[model samples]
Target: MNIKLIHSKVNAVLKAASPITLPVDIESIAKKRGLDVLPYELGPDVSGLLAIKDGKGTIGYNSTETRVRRRFTIAHELGHYELHKEKSDLFVDKQFIYRSQNSPITVDHQIMEHEANYFASCILMPTDQVRKELEKMDIDLVSEEGIKHLAKVFEVSTTAMSLRIDKLGFF
Candidate 1:
């Protein structure tokens, strides 16, 4: 399917259901989705997974990741379900690199990654709300603690939160 089709379909889903925003809690979503969430030690092969068989959703992750990283991974996997699950029942995310938006990468990979990241950020911290929050703070307040708090509010990692903030032009 075309990217536009995928974007429209994803947006429709979000419109039909209230998207998760403030206090973005993945555990809550997992519980709501009837998923069994578990943690595994981080390693070279550490990644996130979601399987649906027999009418159940199961999500697994590397416990070694920081809370933020874990949240992003979970969110990314969730994106696959929301946007591409009918095509494949499973997804494995291996790397969690922090890259610039301009990084040279495959077009398709970059686009999907961008969308997943966008989905994660929007689900955790809707752009409108984040912009409003930024309006009340100084421009230079994107500190580690501040980012962490925003991530907590949005249920994402500091890295993801920072990227979102930057993308939203609040930085």
Candidate 2:
């Protein structure tokens, strides 16, 4: 699946939903797509999983993770559902790691993982909204405090928000 196409699709969904709050309601979005988001005691290495059986799709995230991490995991599984469901009925995502945008993609699994990560980032931190938030704050992106504040506002981990800023070319 093309990362750009998935990003575009997510953007369209966000626009249609018109979320008016800080942390986007990703669970509601999943429910809208006929996905049941559930919490499970997955081990540390496993982040989340998406399973589709008998025309029913379910997303399960690690219940032991922090709320922010769980939110991202749910969004990531939703990405798999959006982009890779036609290819497979089951997807088990492990050890959440995002490849840099410039990194090489040498395998099909790498492609799917990268695309899902990008989808999660885009859905959680839309470019225009993040830019608007930064403009409103007038803060330095390089500063840790600024990143933390933005992360809190978006209800995402500092690492995730920082990566989104870098991907947006905010430096």
Highest-scoring model, lDDT: 2
Task: List model 2 lDDT by residue over 16-114, tens digit each.
Answer: 678646788888888888899999998977889999998789999999999999999888989988888898898887674433455443478778887
State how far residue 128 of model 2 sits from its true place (Å).
1.4
Q: Given candidate 2, what's the lDDT at residue 28?
A: 87
The parts of candidate 1 lying over 4 Å away from their true place are: 1-21, 96-113, 139-155
Cα lDDT of model 1 by residue, 41-131, tens digit: 7585656777777756677888887777787777666666666566556655656432545655567656666666566666666666787
What is the lDDT for 105 in model 2? 38
Question: Lowest lDDT 10-mer window, candidate 2?
Answer: 96-105
Return the TM-score for each candidate structure: 0.69, 0.89
TM-score of 1: 0.69
lDDT of 1 at 85: 60
